[model samples]
Target: MQDVRAGLISAFHWRSDPPVWPEHRIYYADDSAWWREPTILGELGSSLAALFSDEPPTVVMSPESRGSLLGPLVATHLGIGFAEVRKGAERASDDEVWLRRRTPPDYRDRHLEMAVRRSVLRTGDRVLFVDDWAATGAQAMACQQLAGDAGASWVGAAVIVDGLENSADRRLLMLRSLLHLRDLRRR
Candidate 1:
């Protein structure tokens, strides 16, 4: 885990040249380098799962792309199941019911619809959201709402980067990360 944190910091960068960010945001972080390293990749799942080992989730969930990658790793480490959440979904099938919600403005200020199959979350399921980065709690909140809609309890979020600016949002999401955004800068 320590090595993973060091690897993440060494790999991270804050960029402002045509950065992909909202109007009010200053710089965007580039963390793709960390994922390319074998050592970091090897330790990611177990390290992330250890963040909530005291009260491990019954199942883990992640949004479309990145989350789908990390969520399964954590679930595998903890011997739990994983569910991949869909984005901008209506209904996958006539027989299957999906719980979907429109997210609040995200870091990029884009409003997206997040969805998950209704059957994926059973009543009393302890759900934890897993992702590579979390600049805004919008997606996590949307997923949490889906969990509640299905009578599952939330167990907070686990991530590699904690870029959230709002303290209230952090508390509300119960977010934990391997490194904070400020730590990426040269010390």
Candidate 2:
């Protein structure tokens, strides 16, 4: 993960001309935190599928953020079910599955909020988390907390890129970006 994080910081740029953002505000709250390249996203999805090829995952819990788009692609490639974590809404008593989200200070929401949705994970269930990028691990940890609360076993996080130094290093089962600073600097 350390190598992956260094590669991400060196290769990717947050500021791009003409700006590519999603129609939904939740995904791209700010230009600083989203991955907009379609090719990269596709590659990331494929990479995620490859990681689990040995024992292909069965269910994927995607963050309600930008990663949702890529998560489905990965899930489809792996032939699994995809569950989204939606923010600012309450699910029915039976439907409610609580997940914590540690939003960065600049996040549009301006505060931490828990995403609630229909429970897709049952006690002792194995689940994977998919996200576009990871900077501080807050979001990932939050998801872990939610998964723990729901009695689901956390498989790990798969991301397009991770900027935090050593963020993914030593993580038992995480997959990250293929490009590093050297790769991005040339592009």
Q: Which predicted model would earn the best lDDT?
A: 1
What lDDT is obtained when candidate 1 is compared to the true structure? 0.86
lDDT (Cα, tens digit) per residue for candidate 1, span 74-164: 9998889997899987665689888888899998899999989877778899998999888888999899898899899989999988989
Give the range where candidate 2 is weakest over 10 consecutive residues by summed lDDT: 25-34
lDDT of 2 at 31: 30
TM-scores vs. true structure, each candidate: 0.90, 0.64
Cα-based RMSD of candidate 2: 7.7
